[model samples]
Target: MRTSDAQTLIVEKNPNPVADSERDALLLNPVFGRVFTDHMVTIEYSRERGWQNGKVRPHAALQLDLATLVLHYAQEIFEGMKAYRLPEGGSTLFRPGANARRFRNSAERLAMAPLPEELFIESVRALVRIDQKWIPGGDGAALYIRPFMIATEAVLGMKPSAEYLYCVVACPVGSYFKVGSPSVTLWISDQYTRAAPGGTGDAKCGGNYAASLAAQAEATREGCDQVVFLDAVERRWVEELGGMNVFFVFDDGSIQTPPLTGTILPGITRDSLIVLARDMGLAVREEPYAIDQWQEDALSGRLREAFACGTAAVVTSIGNVKGRQYNFTVGDGGAGPVTGRLKDALLDIQNGRVEDRHGWLDRL
Candidate 1:
């Protein structure tokens, strides 16, 4: 195992790990977030002694007190990233620095102790190196890495905890959605609001996701793949989906997505696509879009395509949208050419199939 100069990580190998054959069989059908690797990384923090006791240990359940701060106050934040297998050999991380910075920002927003960027990157790198075998190959497959922080102080109150625990765990995943389904249906939610102004929408925290579950359940009941939220002010402006950021392709060779006005998560994948689209000579705008306008444009043949992007789902086209009073289809109800091209460009950079001009790939 390799150790970075920033921190010396003590490694404790998992005893009685699964046998090689069983592990291979399990890897044959890797489910997202279901089958985890044998080891995990943990680092403790406190007001007295900043960050300490960084180590790689066997994957196991955490022992928490009955009145933990995170359980009560929800002072927690997490990041999602992946380690892709290189075409020639080994594996590499895609834009870990960006994830680290975002994690810090989330911690700041949640009033939790901010983790050092180097430590965050080193922790993720250590886990990936130790569990490199868990990384699946081919398209739509990689080792999904989750780095998270929690307020672990036992004396819970209405304030942030004095102690914290930062951990990293990984699981091999095949695909976020069904392989054959290149496009997905969405339910425009009017009864629920994902985040309000001056909320934690820009932070990658669990509370935001928990709040969106009701709307997601409503979408599920409506027989839709996901739920798209409108703005909380008027419930008319298009915001984002439950977990992924959305994009719109116009017939006039331009792209539009909801602006980040402190009510939407600044997705790394979303930013990457914006840059990739601009590189391809397409005008991209971060502006507010209304649900009524979306339906009107789709119906009038002005909206060419719609799609969502994230770390897990990559890029997924929006085929059909359904609401209580309206329904519409985008671009023949299928994936459009621009959506395909952008998806391929972004995926190619992540998978090392194209030149990484932005210095995003961190080779291991």
Candidate 2:
């Protein structure tokens, strides 16, 4: 609950864990979020008991009442991160402190009790350390860590639930989409918008993502990899992909992304790339990028490349854009030199192949 109370974690090993060979088979080519480890961490909170019963226990199903608040009201928040298997034997987490802070911010936005930053990070560490054997290696594989909080009070009221449950789970994962293909095609959504000016767009809550499913399904029907949403008011400016932030590379060796105006989610990977791009001597700016401008620039050779960034996808090139009025390709419809270099740099630092100039990795 607090920094001083961080050490109250009680760990219970699983009695019947998955066999090593079966885990190895799953790790060979694990699908994202499908294969989980043996253990999980959970913490409970309430008004009377601020935070209690912190434990790293065997993974199992939760016994939630039918009238649970989160089931109907959706008072929940979550954070996504990864634990990379270091080349030198151990494993390391990437920017976990940032994730912890973001989790707190998301909790505040959702009106849920925010867990202490130390406790959040410690929960992740406890689970990943106990399930370290589940972390995959090579081919951009790692252990995907999901930390989430949900309202558990059995009430049917419209107010925030008094009781809450925070849990951490880990899964071995490969590339988010697939291997080999490092780029994606996007379908611009003119009918649906992700968030409005004064909405929960900035929060990492389930409702926001649930709202994007229809658009994503539309993208699938249109034969595209992902959907790109526009501003809710004008439907002109580019906001972001369904789950990732968009970046544009100009012919003048500059980078621009949609500014965080409380509509676009402030992604941790996006922030890290802004710093990394600037450190590489590239001019970076957070500006409002319009869809028509993007089309014109790409067709006129001014927009050299575009890519999306997030915790899951890491960095993926945007090969082409498909809209109702116009369609265009970005720089030969493949990964550009800048995107490749940035991706490699980020991966090198994450996988322990190069020096961590920014100290982003927390080794376990």
Candidate 3:
């Protein structure tokens, strides 16, 4: 019933939505980030017009400028969130408005254009309203929405572009972690740090992600699911994973994570878990947890659990962290009690199985 930015958009429905049975098969084994929803939302920005030409059009290859700033300087930013289909007929957006707010923050940090919070949330609403059928309502499945912005100027300057474009693309995806949310092995990279002091680590940009691919590839070579980066200067503090934020639950019922120290992605799910844990009478501290603590705690059983959280994975229990000199495994090397409970509690609130205590669910 609550609508925000509908005034700016021009809706054009997709003529060819993926057929139901075919879509169902994709949902059954939905490969992450491969398939897409029928439509995408778009808005163009220029120095003169500001933000205009907002539309929801069919998803297809974009005709981009050859000298686009995004192509050359990689002036692009993105946010990832999901829309769940409730047991009732209607669909729901899980804290998508939060994502929109973060996207604006990212834009401001990038010196790119800030999508007005109302416009950002409204574009999502219109697109989801039209493409409600694509939302996978079954078990561990939902429609993943990727809202992105790119510098679209035809000029070949090294500076920020005068023109930019923003869009939201949806994909129906199954659980990000296969094997039913099992523990993941993390390959710690002392070689390439993800974010430096006052760097793009706090912002969700392509370069930060592009900078991690080689480290991620090395992680894959070691038979690990993901890569965790250390602080750029010291390589001592735990920063964040390539795509998610890290959390450690201690045996004493106190939860600690790497504080927002200008060199990490402040994930929305990470923020939610902090609130959720505190609501359940757990002490959650957003402090700089050293890597030595991770190893020592795991060795002593004091580190009860380790999990990664993001829009994609939701919550994945970490099995082991392998560095060059040492390798550590925690809590039977699988999903621990705290990890399981947190995942279920978050899911229940999103799926409408429980009450929306924090007002995160927005029904479509």
Q: Number of the top candidate by TM-score?
A: 2
When 2 and 3 are scored with TM-score, the better candidate is 2
Please provide, for model 2 over 160-221, each residue's C-alpha lDDT reduced to its tens digit, 9 standing for 90 to 100: 88999999988999999758885899999999999999899999999999999999999999
| Steric clashes per prediction | 0, 0, 0
**2 or 3, which is superior by lDDT?**
2
Clashing pairs in 2: none
Clashes in candidate 3: how many? 0
Model 1, 103-164: lDDT tens digits are 99999999998888988998999999988888887778999999999999998578889999
All candidates: CA RMSD (Å): 2.0, 1.0, 2.3
Sequence-dependent TM-score of model 2? 0.98
Question: Each model's TM-score?
Answer: 0.97, 0.98, 0.96
| Candidate 3 per-residue C-alpha lDDT over 1-364 given as tens digits, one digit per residue, 9 for 90 to 100 | 1123335677787788789888777777777899888899988888887787888899888998687778888889999988888886888888877888889889988999888888888888888888887787667788888889999999888897888888899888887877554799999998998889888888899999999999999999999999998888888888899999999999998888998977888899999999889888989998887888889989999998999999899999999999796699988898988888888899888889999989999898
RMSD to native, candidate 1: 2.0
C-alpha lDDT of residue 55 in model 2: 96
Where does candidate 2 have its weakest 10-residue lDDT segment? 1-10
